[model samples]
Target: MPSVRTILALIASSVTVLGGALAEPTVALPATACTTGAPMTTAGYPIPYYAQATPSTGAFENGYQPEPRWAGQHLVGTYTFGVPSPVETGFAYAQFKCQYYCLNQSEGGSFFVRADSKVGSYCECYDDLMDPETFVNNNQTLIGAWNAICKEA
Candidate 1:
């Protein structure tokens, strides 16, 4: 028979191994600061607005305009022309805007634009899309476009 000390040692070893396996894995938090590495460009409108008057009737303009949730957030850019698939096209446009316009124009940080309701023709920008605090405060979740464009940031 095993001695009491030997049994206690084995039980302690098992608990240690089980505790490590059962413990929640540590998740790597996103960086608090990030840079897009794109040169700053001309600062345009602070928030996205209809560059042109709202069209009377169109699939893209369903009279639904997504307003900016963040105050003093710069309008990185707008994507009016969307391909057949709004999600894919929006994502691509987001990447383009982030790389060329948002990174350069807006303060160096994370941002993303996506088509929520409007057809492929309309897209809006959300600055600090990857910030955890912003998400918690605004009750906003990171969209796929953020992953496509702002993941680096």
Candidate 2:
């Protein structure tokens, strides 16, 4: 038989080993870091009819005209631009597209800004001419399209 002191020592060693085995391991997580880059801004606007078409001449009436598919409430367009850091280039491109390609009275407008070093910065504009309900339903599709565009860029 083991001596009392030897049994006590064995029990203490087993307890110590078991305690270590049952204890949770400690994990050292990385510290949270702050964003050190400059801030970005995104903006959008409605295009005016006058900017989309030439003035009416004496012989011909020249004004903004929508295609048959885009006649009433089924028009949609998206424009995207990328720059080093600032959002002005993307904003300007979106504005230009709205002025030249989108309907004069765009009912819905969406803008997104992304700041990334590998992907750089992106500004996106979505021009929606559909009815409110239709636009709402197609919102997911618009977001997916923008994501695709952003990934490609």
TM-score of each: 0.33, 0.22
By lDDT, the best candidate is 1
Separate clash counts for every candidate: 0, 0
**Which regions in candidate 2 have their CA more than 4 angstroms from the true location?**
1-46, 50-85, 103-128, 137-153
Error of 1 at 76 (Å): 5.8
lDDT of 1 by residue, 22-131 (tens): 96889996553342332222122122211111212332322322234442463455544443434554545444444444444444344444344444333334344343
* Model 1 residue 139 distance off true place after TM-score fit, in angstroms: 10
How many angstroms is residue 38 displaced in model 2 relative to the true structure, after the best TM-score fit? 33
Q: Among these predicted structures, which one has the highest TM-score?
A: 1
The lDDT of each candidate is: 0.39, 0.34
